[model samples]
Target: MSNISQLCVILGDQLSADISSLKMANKQECLVLLAELQDEASYVKHHKKKIVLVLSAMRHFAQTLQAQGWQVRYVTLDDPQNTHNFTDEVARAVAEVKVDEVLVTQAGEYRLQQQIDSWQSSLGCTVRCLQDDRFFASIDDFAHWADGRKQLRMEYFYRTMRQKHNILMEAEHPVGGQWNYDHDNRKPPDKSVPIPPPLRFAPDQITSEVISLVASRFADHFGDIDPFFMAVTSEQAEQVLQHFITERLVNFGQYQDAMLTDEPFMFHAHIGFYLNCGLLSPVEAVRQAERAYMEAGAPLNAVEGFIRQILGWREYVRGLYWYHMPDYKSLNFLSATHDLPAFFWNGNTDMHCLSQSIGQTQKYAYAHHIQRLMVIGNFALLTGLSPEQVNEWYLIVYADAYEWVELPNVSGMVLYADGGIMASKPYAAGGSYIDRMSDYCRSCRYKVKLKTGDDACPFNYLYWYFLDKNSELLANNPRMGMMYRTWAKMSDDRKYEIRNSANKFLRNMS
Candidate 1:
């Protein structure tokens, strides 16, 4: 322990009261640093709502710390002395406060982590970056698990996580007979009954101020600023979580993969932003779902399915991100190089699925996982859109998106650019899959049944075209051999028609 005061550096995402930085530093001896830098807010032209959510949450967290009698050096985005970066702010704060030591939590993104790792020499202070205890699995633990594994699959990793955490486990065995309920969770979209809305919070004064600031500063950014009902505080986030458990979790599993026109959130918990922003804890979220299964009698399929996302997919992606960074971003296994279309920004495309998903994203800064993976992401994969271009769009558009989570999901899982590191096979599906799972096909300008005619859905032909084009690379995979065999059986004329249709769609996409 240092005799002098410790400067606790709290990043925007590290808003929790139990964060490692806060825990290690005494309130009386620590001066908390929370800055809203232009450099971070404008990184990749972030969605306006995303900027508002982070800034507002940070402001609230700082106030909460102050109520606990902690001295906080809060820097607003408009602070003229901000110098627009964490490096300058940390240097200025240490020099001004004359703190001898600095305590900080590890950053979620690698870029910021690099900057933090260098701060000790630059700031003339003993800097200690404590492990962020937000997640169940630590980076070191994940590394140990990854070692000597030929293929790192989420199912096996998820089972280990379950046992390690003692969650949904019965004395070394899973509570359920199976480790996954994914098969039961893929029911088609149903609109027979009205879908209940997720909980929404009206903007408080702090959030309103943030909205105004983001509106003026990031006017050209994608997504609507109004109707910004995102839960900016931990209390509000918990309310939303409780609401999901009581009203929505029962059906969440079955319809998790289903999509409907203009129905952005169908039995989905819109807690990604909250979870990522530190408003809610992942472990707590999992425990709550498990409790619902036991006490509230929520279906095991729904509860387990929801828990898998937070426990399995979320943790796996973060681990894989750290496991393969600085090199993972550049992996273009399929070598996709096409440009992202303008419709990604404007939602002006004739494809109903794209228009619905993108428009929802523009309005809410949200889309359920299926809309992301199957609709926008699927189209991007089949169309050969540059992985970098696709990755940037996802990073910018979603409120929950951070580089660690978004990059793996986009470059590795969605685009298959990492060559099956994150996914077993390319989640490639034709329009028929969308038709079966969503209602977008009903309203689509293109016919889902048509494979290659003028009014045919681009996904129909593009799905086969993607397979045909990448057969040399993908055919060797055990999971992809059947698709290759099917493609080989197709007549030359039909194959040509599919290829020609895909080419025409790509040409017109520009």
Candidate 2:
């Protein structure tokens, strides 16, 4: 048996070379453990592509550590002796290697964090759970910023992060004399504009093996495993980042909110898949976008918008997740109880917007934020889908989704199930918003212009339906006053038609 000083556990998501536990370890004395466990893979029937991405990334990262002179213990999912759980694997490793301590970065999800919390008593060793410093704001840092604030807004938190990081700052003011250029950035998709495809990497030998394993074992999973083009290593991930900075950043902000049919990767960075998994650093991605602006390679709207997603929204959701967790998972501020529609799994819906968004997700395990937030997520919101089911569906579908980031976005932003904690008002919108923002409505069977009848867009009536049903909860909200006033002015017969249309749609869905 090798005499090891510590067993450093690097999780599937914690694949970064600069992970805190790895940095704290004496590479010569500590054994690095990277395991592909069945339990984690089967927890929610994750997309096959997501499973392959994580396992392949983990395997590649293990090789990187070994080449760097660290002793590594790699466990494959198909290994005969695998216990398919973290605690059991850690115990087995502790028994095999003479180690005095177990060092690990904090788990990204609350359920996993509970298991990590028990390692000391169960493993009978000193278990050190280090803060994941990859993020700009630590859990404590966010809590401090959130403390005593009646309203927790991403804009204020984002300004603080920009100032703290000196990202777009010139002394006390922003470079463009504005913290946000979103007004300049929301031009609807111009079909005439040239759109570059996201950079795709051919699967290497290690990733090929992972694809084969996931294809067979998770044949029933949500997404297609093959034709997998995700970057599985840091070098490849960096290539993706550089590709975005050069090719996509200039138009990323302008068309960020716009959606086009059959054009899945239009002017989007597609780096969230890499950034969330620790294959690429968020700070590095943010800095590169800033540099592009400084070099006149990309516009201020593009650079600032891209940086805000990572520095502001990404960090904010993570902080909110940790701060409100355990109980945060169960929040149902709207008391929504509808089961997730079966269409979410297979993209079998008449709404072209949803079908396009979900179909893209199933094919690639990727969807840009607008598709997620406004199309698919907005549908879930208006339909009164159960938050738990909605949250699980999101976590299962996206490669970038972990509960820490996914839950807050779904519960608070999408479902409004967290009340007003994450958003001032629900992001509910009618088909007019979709028609204006996307090309999906042009092809949709539902009439985007109609407000009632079977052929009318479900989103049109459902938007009013959601507001009416939740008026007791949302009526007094300042941001919702205009929407309520619009509703109030409608003739009683008109209101009845909207409610009836929504009811019929909900019934048909069930």
Q: List candidate 1 stretches off by more than 4 Å.
A: 1-4
Task: Single out the weakest 10-residue window by summed lDDT for candidate 1.
Answer: 1-10
The digit string of per-residue lDDT tens for model 2 on 262-283 reads: 9988998888888888999998
Q: lDDT (CA) for every model shown?
A: 0.91, 0.92
Q: Clashes in model 1: which pairs?
A: none
lDDT of 1 by residue, 439-462 (tens): 888888899999997899899999
